[model samples]
Target: MSLSFTSPNKTIFIYDSTKTSEVALLQHVKDQTSKLTEVPINITSVTPQLLNSILTRMEPGTSSLLINKTSPWYRCFCEDFSEMNDFILKKTFVKFPSLIQTPIVIHQDEVYVNPSMKHIFDIYEEIYV
Candidate 1:
């Protein structure tokens, strides 16, 4: 499962809508992008294909980037799974989409997981300025 960006100039925002913080982040993204006249932004929910694409962009042993470590499901998953590999992580994410950390911003082939406000602003600057 991989993602091929048809337009390298576009930005993709992947987030879980159910999460309030993620929702806010989505809105923030919208607000920021609204200032740009031509930069295309694709906002989407966290789906299996998107998750796979995110995981592929991540560095090895960085599964934490994709997971909400504070979630109860994460705690239980940690206890049940002896290892934290891509397969297990993907299964876990698929089973509990809520457990996936979101507000992932993909721009210019760079993936930002749970990026801060500063990072978001920086991304916009990089794109529009």
Candidate 2:
């Protein structure tokens, strides 16, 4: 049997699929965090190629983007709202729209996140420390 070592560090690209503040805050957080210490999070463009690369690199320990609260991404940005929703739903990277509205936790092939902050902390503590 191969002795497996887990890589807790991961590249979390806060991809901005649309042109909005969501991109900025995520980018800002990443930038500020960069100055302090190594952050597992990274902000990047959410275009087709970038998103694909992000998923490709995902592994054991990973953190998804915690989009800024006011980000217009929760709803369709373009005039074609219905079509946009359909497109987002169809994509493998964004299959679950629920994750967009609410924070989601995925680990070991599982997805979970509670609405409360403390509960979220518990989950993070279990994963990181």
Candidate 3:
């Protein structure tokens, strides 16, 4: 049950709505994508399938990039997991979505994790403008 983007022009925004920063970023993405008449953006929460898709796109040894280091679950149990592999991290993220980073934007083959406004602008220009 992996997530796939069939349309090359489409953008996918995976985020945690509970986080204020992510919510703000989502609004910014919405504002930017709205200007594009054709390219559509899919905004969604981080599901297991979506998370796996994101993990696959990310570079090796960077699997923990999506984990929220500030999360309580992470702080409490992070040390316990001496062997924190992708599978364990995925399970942990599934159990605690709040423990995963927010506002990951996927545009074509590129996956932006917690992207800044500048990154969004660059993506817009590259894809739309």
Candidate 4:
């Protein structure tokens, strides 16, 4: 028999197909959290408004780091917006959500962009303890 657990708080997972590494990271987060914590994660496709909201919560320069420079989508974005000021870059994400990196994890008011295992643990502790 198998045992399962669920979280009381809503966990929003935003992912994109362009980021292969993020996909694996997202899976690892789910598995680790399932085993170590009671946080139930819900995976969802990202939206433009959602991207805008996440960026709004972050510092100007910090949010831009979430852009996946190696992805083909980024190549085109760089070509088009060669010199992206903070405002323009944030606006662009609101227009084209796919241009940003994934998988973003949003737990309540906190948001994690391209989360690591350490990041997941930190958030879990913040919420649970």
Candidate 5:
């Protein structure tokens, strides 16, 4: 028997809850993808403020994580992003190098981005699927 996650039926769209514009874009992407592929998706616009709450909702080892840093204005996100990454790393015991403004895969669960969303989704699809 193989171990696995009991994934939720809805596809969650996690994002930096503080960024309203990004959230809107994420919703747009979800809408476009759903219409194109007929996938049942649910948008989960989350932020670091709800970090713990968000983590608690995920099924163990069932995350399709991505960290994107495509904007020049990222000093803001890094603060909360770093804190959130640290929290997850401690919980999962995965390690990543320090961020000098680059996106990375933290704890093998989350992605730390420094600017790569276009190809990142393709990467996410490759890994998760």
Candidate 6:
């Protein structure tokens, strides 16, 4: 399945909850992406296609960084599973999208999984300027 954009805007944000410690940062990214792109950012939960796109396009390190290792969901998976790879993880995400991390930002051809403000800002500047 292919990921479809609801809007013509080129950015997509896969965020979990607003209650996270990164709420402020996520808001900042939303505001900036909106202002700079002149279109609302596409905020969504992790859908199957979205997860597939992320698994295929994003680097393994960045994708792994987004996972909440301490979450009960993850802990349980780790307890039962010994070997882990991108393929297995992708399947897991397909089943439990909520278990995946949040604030996954995607722009034109760039995918930032749980990135820092500096990284987002850099991309924004490069694209908008």
- Among these predicted structures, which one has the highest TM-score? 3
Candidate rank order under TM-score: 3, 1, 6, 4, 2, 5
At residue 40, candidate 3 shows an lDDT of 14
> Over the stretch 1-129, how does candidate 6's per-residue lDDT look in tens digits?
344443434566655554464667767765655532211112444455756665666665555655666556886786534466667777777676656665667775567766788987877675444
lDDT of 1 by residue, 46-85 (tens): 3567567777667767767776776677777766554766
Residues 13-104 of candidate 2: C-alpha lDDT, one tens digit per residue: 23233535434434543453332111112232224343333333444233233223343454443333334432353262343332332233
lDDT at 124 for candidate 5?
50
lDDT of 2: 0.34
lDDT of 4 by residue, 81-117 (tens): 6578766776776555656666667665566777876
Where does model 2 exceed 4 Å of error? 1-43, 48-99, 102-105, 113-115
Give the root-mean-square deviation of each candidate in angstroms. Answer: 4.5, 9.7, 4.1, 7.5, 10.5, 4.4
Q: Which portions of model 6 miss their true places by more than 4 Å?
A: 6-9, 35-45, 60-63, 79-82, 85-87
Question: In candidate 5, what are the lDDT values of residues 38-115, reduced to their tens digit?
Answer: 111113222333334334444554332333344443444446554554356333312221212222222224333323
Residue 74's lDDT within candidate 6 is 80
Q: Give the residue spans of candidate 5 off by over 4 A.
A: 1-11, 34-116, 125-129
Is candidate 1 or 6 superior in lDDT? Answer: 1
Worst 10 residues of 1 by lDDT: 35-44
In candidate 5, where is summed lDDT lowest over 10 consecutive residues?
35-44
Candidates sorted by lDDT, descending order? 3, 1, 6, 4, 5, 2
User: What Cα-based lDDT does every candidate model obtain?
Assistant: 0.63, 0.34, 0.66, 0.58, 0.35, 0.59
TM-score of 4: 0.58
For lDDT, the strongest prediction is 3
